[model samples]
Target: MSPVPNARVLFNAIPQGVPTPGQTTVYDSSQSIDLESHPLNGGFLIKTLVLSIDPGMRTRMRSTEEKSYATAFEIGQPLEGFGIGVVLRSENPDVAVGKYLQGRGFLHQQYFVLPSLPFGMFFLDRHPALPLTTYVGALGLPGKTAWAGWKDYSRAKKGETVFVPSGASAVGTMVIQLAKLDGLKIIASAGSEEKVEFLRKLGVDVAFNYKTVDTRGVLEREGPIHIYWDSVGGETFNAALDNAAVGARFMECGQMTTLNSVGSHAITIENPMAIFGKSVSIHFITSFLIIPKHLEEFNRVVPAALVAGTLLRSPEDVRHGLECVGEMIRAVQSGETRGKAVVVLGEA
Candidate 1:
């Protein structure tokens, strides 16, 4: 059998600011795979289906000294990320051939032969009501992060107002839905008018373009925010700090303001002492905090909500093939790719 082109998005060089496509990341399709003869010592061979490019991956492009919860992407190697793949051949009983498996830390390639299934890998539902692409968006890690924040960090009662920054991002989309589900009022913002329009479509109490509006003024007018979904750290965060109500809760996730920081992520807070004055409680949200029951509940409930037309599905920016993967990666790093950015390598 002819060797198959195992194209991959390689992390070639780290960038100081926004990553440059074809420079920071390289697309290499010259590598070939012998699907028929690739080693499978109690292992499996999989053809990549969809690869996810997330904003968090941008941080991993830096040196190992820059520590984070996620492992740094190895230079000259395939960038690992959340991806769905179909088993082409397998010897492991648990890894059935032809089943779609979802995994993090998957070598971003067209085809891969693994010695064994990656840890935490699992098969997706056989007949999901939604497309498999949704797994990389609404049901992906970002969704999980949103769920964790709402379920554990956000201690808002019904009718209380929650302000979400970056409300059009992948995490932001889920945060919007979660707030609605719990009967909380939402005041959210995006960087663009188009995204603001989308937030309005989602039926938010207030949606504004952060680029144009003064966040402090908006929060003053419509908030004393009961819950602050803090993804953007900087002046916006300072504004949130100033506007948070006494005993308010803050769901702290990624500090998106630092993604393209020219130097260090450090930024001066106008009123760092405001939280103390207000007695605000800030909770760090992570999927690790979500137990197995939460995952089961999420799997059961979110699907039903989607089927019942109760949930606003995640907005996605999709691309196809390995060449375009570099483009998407660069777009995400540059904060240009909205919602979830995924690349399709093969069909389900």
Candidate 2:
């Protein structure tokens, strides 16, 4: 067997207010790293590919009360997220070497040295019929977010009308498809004209450019939306409130539109009057706090939907190399990129 060679790891030091060229840091290797043989628990080394750059990451980058989800990325520590990786070495029985897996909290490194349990690892077997990247996209977090939020929070019934903003995004697209499968009438809004057309092809009953037309106005004439699964909060969430049916359910899953700010321009709905009067329920959803029971249910429901034709998988937007990982964040922030922007670290 060949000896283990040195690995290069890159980390984001000093959070810049905005992403510019040559602002982040890249290291050859840290000499401080003890390579000496030591007992490793459930040990595994992974070569990362297709790193997930999610909006939740933006909150984690900050140092505030809202950053309670996960500890903020340290100035000199490896940045982390859900990523697909190939196992290069392993001491764990469950995780064998040479297998591919999807891992959460994986940095933008070419190789990872995991000392603890693979708490977030989901074994990704080769799907001959499907692209592997889908494990990090449609069959991944975004897809899971759509599925879990809709299934648990919305509790959507058949023949109900569901409205989703940012409907062309990776999660949004999956939500649209899942809602349709539940036999719900799907109405969607997107930023651009092209996205509107894209949603139409996905069987959306009414796809509109939210930038051109007033969402609430359009919905008022349309009448009685049963569920509003919001991916983009701020104006979109406020607008959704206006169109919500008497007993409608609303799921606040994400806050992409407000960037990282906490302020809400939300008009106070008379909760005791309008909502209590109408008996509508508002639910805030996040997969981060999901319990083991819910996660087990997720593991079963998700893979099955993916293996079957129930969920529609969107193509992943891949950015090559660890250095370009910032571009993935920028794309989502700018609202320029469609679907999930993943950084490919090594060759597939």
Candidate 1 pairs with clashing backbones: none
TM-score of each: 0.94, 0.82
RMSD of 1: 1.8
lDDT of 1 at 27: 88
- lDDT score, residue 157, model 1? 85
Q: What tens digits encode model 1's per-residue C-alpha lDDT throughout 140-199?
A: 777777876687778768999999988987788888988887898899998778888889
Model 2, residue 202: displacement in angstroms? Answer: 1.5
TM-score of 1: 0.94
- Candidate 1 segments exceeding 4 Å error: 126-128, 291-293
Overlapping backbone residue pairs in candidate 1 total 0
Best by lDDT: 1
lDDT of 2 by residue, 125-166 (tens): 667777667777777777777777776777789988899887
Give the Å error, residue 312, model 2: 2.0
lDDT of each: 0.81, 0.70
> Candidate 2 at residue 80, lDDT?
79
